[model samples]
Target: MQPVRRSSRLTRNTISAPETAASSSRKNSRKSSQRRIRCTPPPEDSEPEVESLSEENSSEEEEDMHEEILPKETRYENSRTAFQGLYQEKPDLLRPSKKPLSARFLTQGARERTSTVADAGLLYTVCDSDSFQPSIVREFVANLGDAEPRGDGVAVYVRGSLIEFSPSLINTMYCIPHCEEDSSWMDEKLDKVCTLLSGNRIKRWEDMSSKYLTVTNQVLYKLVCSNWIPTMSYTAMNAERLRFIYMLHLRKGFNFGKVIYNQIMRMAENTETEKKRRIILPTLIQQVILIQRNVPPDNSDEAESDFPKLVVKDKKAGLGSGVDSKEPDLEEDIDQAISFLKGIRSRLKRGEYPIQRKNEDSESG
Candidate 1:
């Protein structure tokens, strides 16, 4: 009876151990499933936030890149402005001897390959297509580079890219007017004029002026004023005289007699006190004016004559003074320039254009 009771108790203990092992296995599986869910990405609601952050980072990087790519010219211009401001506070630094930088050159290599007709056309196209100020037309070419020969296209670097325009394509843009002289000579003159006007030394007039002015006339005016190349503060002309001269050259249809009289009158009217403190026009300005006045108008009939009749008249009164509309006062420099130009023109008309004399020519002739 005792053996039978002990066997039944052992059976009951074995059944309870199996139930405990099964429960423990089920609990471990539940914990593993919970961990798997937690390890995964967030829900759809958070996607926008993640993308927005990425976009913001990208925008910041783009801005940084833009700042790095600013042009060298822009940096130089800013520096120059800053320097000018600083110089203003220190007047002594502006003394004439302190030769502030004169001008900068900025032209492209392809410009050299362009024919005069092409250049004129391109310039006109730019003027028509863009609402650029008229003064911009007068600005100088700064960085002219070498051009390849005809037939083979020239490479132009503009608008931040390199482009090739063959001579034929460029010629199609505009037909240049034919002149009696070689077209190449005209091309050289046009290029020179364009370069001087567009040079970086002076800001373009169109940028400064608001009204409408003919592009060709404005270019012509720039050529006339180019005589005063240096800053007037240090020269005998002074700022005022230079400005006056520039205006006089640019203004059209003004009576020369009245203008000259008015100028003299203004000087005379100045008080003794003011006259004592006043600075006068430079000898160079006087020389330039004198030269312009003395240059006789082209007279084909009298051109070759050794003694052309010089008509002298006075302006104020017939008895004491007769107005002489035609003669220029003969100053030494003006006479010299007039004589030189006359000789040059004569030689050119005679089909004997002067060429640089070589040692061979000297020896043979």
Candidate 2:
């Protein structure tokens, strides 16, 4: 009777053949296969398993069907320790091999771009630490007024802080634009960093705790040994600048080598302005000894003199050349010291500079 008067509505609603049953079966199969293909993420209390899918022969249609059956916003996360903000790949999948972590070891143009990302994270970890408990961090979050700037970037100094003398640290954070062809992006990144540093008022490394101090020191050490700045050259810094650097390391119980003295002298000699260089020369020599935690030798006969004892002699115009002249021989002693230094160098080269015996009997006797 129904076949004689079959209506479209009834036909549409009716489960006609075993095809419907088969469809149901297919859906069940997909759910089972998908569950096996991708395991449910482990519960918080449970350890995660690293499992590979065994559905190598699974058809694309079947895969698509499986995807359609799965619900959106699954409560799953990767077992990897990496932060969720960085990667979004499926959990339990095998990661590919990777090269060394060092930028120096990395090949090609990878390092140039990664320099910002990798180092940004490095600096963040540093700047984000809680070591400022003993100090202040300036927070640099944005939109804070009536804030005082405590330090200077152009003339940076650090007291009892090793991170301060890090020229690379300063260079990396400074806002100078990049010189590369694709510097727009790099410059943007640099500008963003520099703004962050400035806005937060982190003019000194002492503003940051020692969270990433190791990396920071290593970077500066490499930069120094390589005779390089990140985006600039190692032109001679003046004595005031060097004193600033020296005091930073000194307070941290750091010592300078004799090479530092030679380098400073070389820079002083290279200065075009003779008077200015002379002024810096004595101060630099004084700082070198002071920072090394060494007492200056007593050169005065009375041992208590107004002049500061250092590598530069304290002899004034009274016992100096051009003493009788009206115009000051502003560089008289300095010039003699320079000449003496040159003589020492020449004698040392020829093995003629020998140690003088203080207790030798007089030639007259």
Output the number of the TM-score-best candidate.
1
Stretches off by above 4 angstroms in model 1 are 1-127, 131-153, 157-162, 165-169, 175-326, 329-365
* lDDT for each candidate structure: 0.36, 0.33
**Local error of candidate 2 at residue 173 (angstroms):** 26
> Residue-wise lDDT of candidate 2 within 214-305, one digit each (tens)?
33232332233222111122232222222222222222221122223334334434554444432222222223223334342334313321
C-alpha TM-score for every candidate: 0.17, 0.15
Best model number under lDDT: 1
lDDT of 1: 0.36
- The per-prediction tally of clashing pairs is 17, 1
Residue 54 C-alpha lDDT in model 1: 85
